[model samples]
Target: MLLMMAEVLAFSRVSEALPNSTFWQFLSFHQSHVEWVGCSLHDLIQPSFSFLVGVALPFSLGSRLAKGATFGALLRHTMVRSLILILLGIFLRSMHSEQTYFTFEDTLSQIGLGYTFLFLLGFYSPRVQLIALVLILVGYWAAFALFPLPGAGFNYTLAGVTPDWQYNLQGFAAHWNKNTNFAWDFDRWFLNLFPRESTFTNNGGGYSTLSFIPTLGTMILGLFAGKTLKDNVAPNQKIKKFVITGVLLLIGGLVLHLTGVNPIVKRIWTPAWVLFSGGWCFLFLAFFYGVIDVANYKRWSFFLMVIGMNSIAAYVIADGLGAFIGNSLAIHLGQDYNLLFGLPYATLVKGALVLLIEWWILYWMYKNKIFIKI
Candidate 1:
């Protein structure tokens, strides 16, 4: 949630302000999404969020079941939550558009598209869940690998890729190239079914609705981790399991990419990316679990806990209210107020203020016991 807020607050502008500082530049690079074929800190944000959703499911399911909820009730709630998430994603994406943007590539919509399946899988044994994960990964990979690449006479420009586009992969890997692969073609048909300002073309960033498949795989991984944590096992065993699984996944993803069997493309949520990003997600969970839960280092995470608890609310505020808050600050404080920190730091100051206001909103929600869940 903080990372999402940072993106909205334009924290990367700090790097722009401090162009000469290598440290700031490095941080800024990670703050922004990578163009293609590589992972950045920002790239991991969506995967982490999606993965954590799966991680939380076991507890959520257990709590509701213990409260005497039936499968019918839980399934209904899951459907409703999925619908809300999908519509919410569209609404947020449409905030600046002419008509309702029907894109389903955003994080929420992508998760929503797969949440029902994830929920259904939660009822099964871990072995079944693992089987589902393998099927999803392999099936998705094969689908892409089998999709025919563009012919020589095909116009790259029509698909928004230039003839000499630097990121275009060659040979088999080209099957996952931006704007020209299976998901892109699928969206060409699927998204146009809804109302649009114009005919839907390729998503500029190559994100596709079909990515929800592998995203489900990511969630399944989280499900495994969540179950491990929730089970009556020693802390060290859980930590060990997470670490070993993380290492294996990381290596698996790298091997796939290195072998040119598949590429790790987050925009498309390629199967290899599921393994790669899932690896990082596991390691991250292990670290946090070790420090906060096992080691009892609770005090420092209070700030994060506030945001984490009200993540949906925080997400809404960050996406919906950031501009309003920034404008309000400028109205009250004067446009030049940010310049107090000098010209280069103007963006930094304004963004910092915006972040503080957003955090306070979450803090207020936390204190008042007003978490917005979906």
Candidate 2:
């Protein structure tokens, strides 16, 4: 959550302050996923967030079931929550627009698109969920592999690829190329079904609405992890399972990419990307669970808890309130003050102040026990 909040502001500041700086470049690498392959902190945000939703499902369902909630009631709640998330995503993306963007590629919208399916999976056994996960990945892969690859004469430059781009994969791999894929094509039509000021051509980032299909695989991985955590196994045994599972996922994802079967591209949320990101999510969960849940080291986690407890509010504020808060700071502190210490340092100060204020708001909400759950 902190990473997502600070990412754009911090990276832009550093890059603007020190153009062509290798340090900023490396930091930006961590802040954004590579276009074709590799993982990073920023890329992991959506996956981890979606995965955690899956992680929480068992507990949520269990709590409701314990309270004698009916399946019908649960389904109704699921629909409402999903709708809320989708609408909120659209609202956030349309903040500075005249009309709704109607985009489904945002993290909230992507999650919302698949949330119902995931909720349904919560009732199934782990074995069944694993099968569903496999099916999703394989099915998505088939869609790509079965699609016709762009011909050799096809223009790459128009699609943002260098004419001499060497990373271009051959055979079925070309079907999964950035802008010229089944998913991207489907999006060109699907997104156009909504009101638009202009005809939809392509997502500049190469993201597609259909990426949610493979994203389901990431959530299913979380379902497995949540099941493990909810099991009657010992703490040490659970930790071992998590670590092992995480390692296997990482290996599986990399093997696919390295063998030229699939490239781990997050923009389209490819199957390999799902496994790779899901692996990191599991490892992250393992670390936090090991220290706090297993070792009972709770003192150092208070700060994190404040943000975690009201994550929805934190996310909304980060996305929608950033500009307002920045401008407010500029007014109070004077724009020149930020540049007094140098543009780079000023950028850092402004970002830090914004984050601090955001944290304080979250902290206040936490203290008041006002968690805004979707």
In terms of lDDT, which candidate is strongest?
1
> Candidates' lDDT values, in order?
0.92, 0.85
Candidate 2 stretches greater than 4 Å from native: 19-23, 152-171
Error of 2 at 233 (Å): 1.6
Scored by TM-score, the top model is: 1
* Native-to-model Cα distance after best TM-score fit, residue 343 in candidate 2, in Å: 2.1
Tell me the TM-score of model 2.
0.95
lDDT of 2 by residue, 1-374 (tens): 87888853577567767887998877867877676667778888889999998898898999999999999999999999999998998899888888888889888988889999999988988888989998999999988888877677876654656545665556656777878888987987899999987777778888889988888788888888888888899999998888988898899999988888988888888899898888899899999999999999999999888888988998999998888899998898887866766767777778888988999999988888899998
Q: Roughly what TM-score does model 1 have, to 2 decimal places? A: 0.98
Instruction: List the candidates' TM-scores in order.
Output: 0.98, 0.95
Lowest summed lDDT over 10 consecutive residues: which window, candidate 1?
7-16
Runs in model 1 with CA error above 4 Å?
A: 8-11
